[model samples]
Target: PTPAAPHREQAAWWAVVGWLGLLLQVLLRVIRGAPSSLAKLLRSLGLRHPLLSAAPAVAFVQLPSKAPADDLPPLSPPPGRLTVVLDLDETLVCAYESSSLPATVRTQAVEAGLHCFDMEGISSDKDAKGRQRVNHVTVFERPGLHEFLQKTSEFADLILFTAGLEGLSCRTFILLSIKSPVSN
Candidate 1:
């Protein structure tokens, strides 16, 4: 390599860092409702230091100025309504593979009058013969789950968030009598 290779690489790195710092500063200004000029922004962020003074400009994109709220239409839902986001596993209910769940625990949950249901889900793993397996899951509702849903749905829109399979999540919400506007 040439003697100046390291210096060139270092300068390039600083240029990238400067660009990222400038973008972050702009975003922070927008969030804080502050206005700034490009030169003033760079000076304020210390990007004009001797080490970065010779670095080439990274980007020249122009950011749009913030518009007045009065000039825009209302984007939120009606005042009385709100969004209620709930997670599926461990938040609203607990689920386990029927094969792995102990019989005693199942019996105790049933005896305790905790609402429970069974659903079949596809396994992400291959079976012994290298074929996809169907997993039977037993889901138990957390205490006061029903009442919480009833009260929350009264004045808010409910959204279910889960990393589980789409079909499995939809089926669970269906069984719970709640709408599932689920996304991955």
Candidate 2:
């Protein structure tokens, strides 16, 4: 097994036939809709200039523009100012992790008057003497959440959003005091 193992197995079988001939020339230039040009597909796979001087001699295609929605530009919404976006966890409230909450579901949601609270955040993790942990949550509202944000802020412009963890929805909207003007 020497003689440089048959020239290192014929240079790893021509480096797997030069990466399967550069992935069959990029799958036949993406099934022939062509016009790619990574330096003309590495100079049609003979690949030179040290791999065509690091590619990019035009290959940014875009395409979509049959133009004709009356030359597009009229997605409306601003002749009366209405915004309303809302959705902070389960739509308008329902947190939990106050150390795995459950003191009889926080005393039956505070004797069923609901509208709970207890947010507090700050913890992208870092303790063991680096400080920055304090997490606790709780939240709860969502029974006509403050009369649907005071009747959608007297006609839209509410926002609030959260795909989860914007520091626990900005500490559940500053512990649900919400006088608005939150920002980021």
Q: Which residue runs of candidate 2 sit more than 4 Å off their true CA positions?
A: 1-79, 82-97, 100-105, 110-125, 129-136, 161-165, 170-184
The prediction achieving the highest TM-score against the true structure is 1
User: What is the per-residue lDDT of model 2 for residues 3-107, given as tens digits with 9 covering 90 to 100?
Assistant: 899999999999999999999777655534454565577668875653335446687989876987888898987578578677778777888888899789889
Q: What are the Cα lDDT values of the candidates?
A: 0.77, 0.73
> Each model's TM-score?
0.52, 0.28
The digit string of per-residue lDDT tens for model 1 on 1-184 reads: 9999999999999999999999987665553443346545776877664332433458578866987788898788658768878998788989998999999999999999888889998877889999988889999999888788888877778787888877677778887774323323
